[model samples]
Target: MFATESGGVRRNSLKDFVNVKANGKIAMKLADGDKLVRVRTCTEDDDILLSAHGGKCIRFPVTGVRVFVGRDSKGVRGIKLAKGDEVIAMSVLRHVKVGVEERDEYLAAVNAARRLKGGDYTKRAEDKARDEELAAKLNEEKFVRMAEEEEYLLTIAADGLGKRSSAYEYRIAGRGGQGIANIDLARGKKKTHVAAAFTVLDSDQIVMVSDSGQIIRCSIDKISIVGRSSRGVSIFNTADGEQVVSVSRLRDVNGDDEEGDEAEEVENGGPEAEAAPQGNEEGEEEPPEVDGAGEAEGDKAGGGEEETP
Candidate 1:
């Protein structure tokens, strides 16, 4: 799956580019000012989440897009953007069937338990009592099932504030529509924009880099999980006029594991895995090889580089 900054989405079969040479083949033809924002491997049952710099995100199923017959075509719209908004990140999430009432109940119970565990005493006595009662009514089996299927999303702002939110907070919607608020940008006095948004695991570590060349690495578990629309705590303290430009996840390495995961490939926007070249079969067209001279010329002709996400 390939997504562009202009909300275009394209899904092509892996067999389309068999026997790719040293120079990669053109995956999709982008629009005049559009650039590739994300590329991820996904299944038909998975949901695609697109996040914009304006703190808006839209989640839609992968089945919403049809497989393209050729790689040269520009795909269909994935999310509608506002006047000054552009997509920053894309993530693939598992599709789960959940009811509105069930989700509300689960969230209430979870929040109550979290507050109780943190020893929150700012609420009124009656409110605390109600929260305790709600926490006590949590269904153990249902909580366990929901926890097993839950995914956490980490969203960072350019001003260095960030938070972890449950993926369930983002409800699936139709493609080509303005999305719900991803973070609370209006709560702060200073103007801020979303720097990055992606699904992360508890054991994952993240490295953030600022435009001024400052870098900070922190454990994902240290970030506090909050409501979807709440302003997050500061994860990095940037200097004057500094802003975070990039964020990358570092997976925990397990020495005892028999099967190792593939190394992540860094691209224009973020980390993405390139499709491996497959052997050609009979009657298959061979990919054209690009000489070093032609490759440099081709890049020069491409013109206008993509902005770093």
Candidate 2:
């Protein structure tokens, strides 16, 4: 017999339930991890009851709504969706919490489902093996979830290093009592393979006032924030891929923008400041957020203080 993954197994196994009826008869058996669909309901008691049974439920404005249906996909045999009982997938809710994680999970699940229906299992033994494979695939996805925190802090150690005159300078002006105690990555910040360096401007008062009121600058390179984590500011070498700075190294920087101060913010956390950070508020775009669960081995990787607001 061919291997289950060779397309022969799934197709062979589906011989039993291959012809799933999706008409108004209501014979669908929900999968083990059936997504919780939000629907309009009528009462709190009803909502709780449906949720407890793993059935989708939602309150209608104020009234708690619930739909008593089968645990499987076709729903109950005779029972049907009630008026205002809209079935919306919980996938939407999960996405709002962490789009990346939810997206990854959905992809993994879909791949597994496809593998399940691929082979032609004309025999009982083939069916058993297919089911086992599908179960294993789903079980594996339980571990690859995304995380949530998106802020970080990096230590500013270099002075006037990696300076470029071409692009505009990205300056974070210090605020009142904000004493560069630490560098904040701010939420929605993302880390990428394309690297940049943060430098502190130097002068005669370098050693003395250097601790505060000095302009802290970050040189960005790329324009993408692909696969980042939610840890606070932590620096890494652009070439060797080694982490370098951190938040505790944060110190005071120069004051916030003046009436005529003209430096621009980094665009999309990119090294090249040819353009202003997309939004008005500085690098607060879609910072790579992970809920602290999926810290990648590498290619996952921040900021300094003694800077301005």
Candidate 3:
């Protein structure tokens, strides 16, 4: 765990974290500090610091400091700080906050997106449209980038059709970047992580990975295809058996399966035809027929051929 200080959040033990100092520690625009919740770091790892927010470590550096609760059969997860929290080694040291980094990265990205693509992420039908427009643009750009990267990961995994049988999983939940960041971590740490992920859901589903590099399913978040980006398209599974996959660019595998199954089916199912309005068989208009007499008469009238009644 860690303690928030003027310099920044410092490494702390579970036993030391107690109160929020009620004085020195400060909260910024986006951050909400538990006025009564103070923390300290122990000589140990961030576990005691973790205790402040209860055994739940979901909100790590965000919640102050944290410790790893032993992983049970259920899954890997954590909760917020505990009440009357004490079992923390709250270090009074300091570390830089990521909020600024987040803000800058998003700002730079959004500005670029606005200039390149004329989409108004800034939906300012309101009075404070200026700031609102800016924030909306930033958020949209961030989400789009996330979705595109996930698609890239999916395509790389679909190299072999033989991958349908096995799987991997991960259950990720966060308001911002934690889930994505953690997934990135797993991908790098595990062999063939990209080869195992196929469906990137907002929900967690992967479970296991073989030591050799194949993958198993975990309880990760389920990402949706509907209301999603047109990026990754391959469903993949690796023989190495690494379950969880990160949304990164192992390759520029994003594909547009535009003429996929649906397109091919429609084309092959019908005779060569132009797009036309539908109607009842009998109600449909018929093509004009030509009679031998009419053809001779028209030709004779045009002075091309003589007509024989």
Best TM-score goes to which candidate? Answer: 1
Sort every candidate by TM-score, greatest first.
Answer: 1, 3, 2
Top-lDDT candidate index: 1
Q: Write candidate 1's Cα lDDT for 1-309 as tens digits.
A: 888887667777777778999989888777698888889989998999888777778888887665655677666677766665778888999997888788878888889989888775785788789889888757678777987899988899887899999988888876766677888776344666788888888877777888788888787899999998787999999976677888877785454333233223222233222111121111112232222111222234323222111
- What is the per-residue lDDT of model 2 for residues 1-309, given as tens digits with 9 covering 90 to 100? 000100000001123234567664322233343332222212222111110011111111111111212222222111112222212111001112334554455444444555565645566677657565644545443333322211111122112111111001111221111111111223234322111212222210111112223333332221111111112222222233222222111223343331322221111111211111112211212233222211222323211111110
For residue 12, model 1's alpha carbon misses the true position, in angstroms, by: 1.9
Query: lDDT ranking from best to worst?
Result: 1, 3, 2
RMSD of each: 11.5, 28.6, 32.4
Error of 2 at 34 (Å): 45
Give the distance in Å from residue 17's predicted Cα in candidate 1 to where it truly belongs. Answer: 3.0
Model 1 regions more than 4 Å off: 122-125, 187-189, 253-309
Q: Could you tell which candidate, 1 or 2, scores higher by lDDT?
A: 1
What overall lDDT goes with each candidate model?
Answer: 0.73, 0.22, 0.25
**Which residue segments of model 2 deviate by more than 4 Å?**
1-102, 105-211, 222-229, 232-309
Q: Compute the lDDT of residue 209 as modeled in candidate 2.
A: 15
